[model samples]
Target: MAIEWPTTQLEKQSDDPMVILNPKTWSHYHSYGGWGKFFDGLRERKLLATRCSNSDCGEKRLWLPPRCECPDCWHETQWVEAPQTGRIYTWSVVKYPGELFKLPAGTPLISVEIEGVCTKLMSFLKEGTPEIGMAVKAVFNVDNPTNSILDLAWVPA
Candidate 1:
């Protein structure tokens, strides 16, 4: 089913419990700030990660969700190209997602474990079934970029 916004007034569903369906309509201005490069990389079909610039920092692994500062030393981070290939560490089918979820229900969500990355990147499977230890590659929605994390997906490699 397609998502539709309610244009009419709020509808009261119950009286004893007090429940109502309130229609909300508003525009929110948001900025990715230092993380804008991550979204831009998605459009360019590139996966960007962040690494601590401080030489003294103990953490040398790349961060998938690029950070503006290093968590260890609080130093500045540098952008680096991440490995496109990874293995599905875990997965589950989102049979009943929230209303704001753009994708349809039953979509397979996966946690990818890429080498050199310190953490698992959460993304959806674009095609094929997911399994533990399944090899996968990053696929970008460059043709129709959403400027969001949804623009990145994984497919069986």
Candidate 2:
């Protein structure tokens, strides 16, 4: 004899976190005060960095994530445009997306060392398999951008 399952639903809370929230407002905000120039560079399809302008500090390291002060000498920094080309210092492929991130599996995250910059930049790769020490170039999302760091990605040079 075949058995018919009960048509009943349980109205109970489980261990799973609330997957969605509605009737709520969300927005992206940023002062971009110290970093406004950097984002402005992106809008123009250029890469910019900051470096110490102090004369005594022999180190002229270019910082990718521009800083207001030099880490070595604590001197004030100035803006400088960086070349678009660089090499993959190292990278990782995310096989799964995070709860807040909507990326497909196997997406590549890379640390790029620009040609004349001292610091390495963390960015995503657009296509192809990632390899260490491989030359790459920056690709800007000129048409549309969310103003997030996702506006820029890399590709093989």
Candidate 3:
């Protein structure tokens, strides 16, 4: 008896190199672990940051992409509410994004510099044009959360 194989044909896009588009559909289960609180805060319309717990640590600044542990002293970090408003430290217009990008092309990606935060937070600009020193405020998707970093965005303040 002969073994039966899948008969579904893949759509070919290129003829020279024989590039074919393989259709795929599946659910991906992911866990944020310690970073769960950051997403949770987005649901509540709040920006959560992390700081080194050790008082003696020289780096006394908040981390926007909340670090689980201090990179300097390797000490545990604690969650803290970060400033919702910040200035655009830098930005770039993404004309062509990756396959998994949630936003459309031409979206302005920005790095926000919040007060007291040691590092900049990378997020997308939801409205208006982006400038190097433009003031922006955090906007959350509280009504219908995606439970991902997409839930957080920024807009002109």
Best by TM-score: 1
Per-candidate Cα lDDT values, in order, are 0.94, 0.85, 0.93
Residue ranges of candidate 2 with Cα displaced over 4 Å: 1-28
Identify the runs in model 3 with alpha carbons over 4 angstroms from their true place. Answer: 1-27
- Once model 3 is optimally superposed onto the true structure by TM-score, how far is the C-alpha of residue 148 displaced, in angstroms? 1.0
lDDT of 1 by residue, 1-157 (tens): 9989877767889998989997779988999999999999999889999999999998767998999899999999999999999999999999889989999899999999999999999999999999999999999999888888999999999
Q: Which stretches of candidate 1 lie over 4 Å from their true place?
A: 1-21
Worst 10 residues of 3 by lDDT: 59-68
Best by lDDT: 1
- How many clashes in each structure? 0, 0, 0
As a whole number from 0 to 100, the lDDT of residue 70 in candidate 1 is 94
TM-score for each candidate, following the candidate numbering: 0.88, 0.78, 0.84
Clashing residue pairs in candidate 3, if any?
none
Q: Which consecutive 10 residues in model 1 have the weakest lDDT in total?
A: 3-12
**Considering TM-score, where higher is better, how would the candidates rank from best to worst?**
1, 3, 2
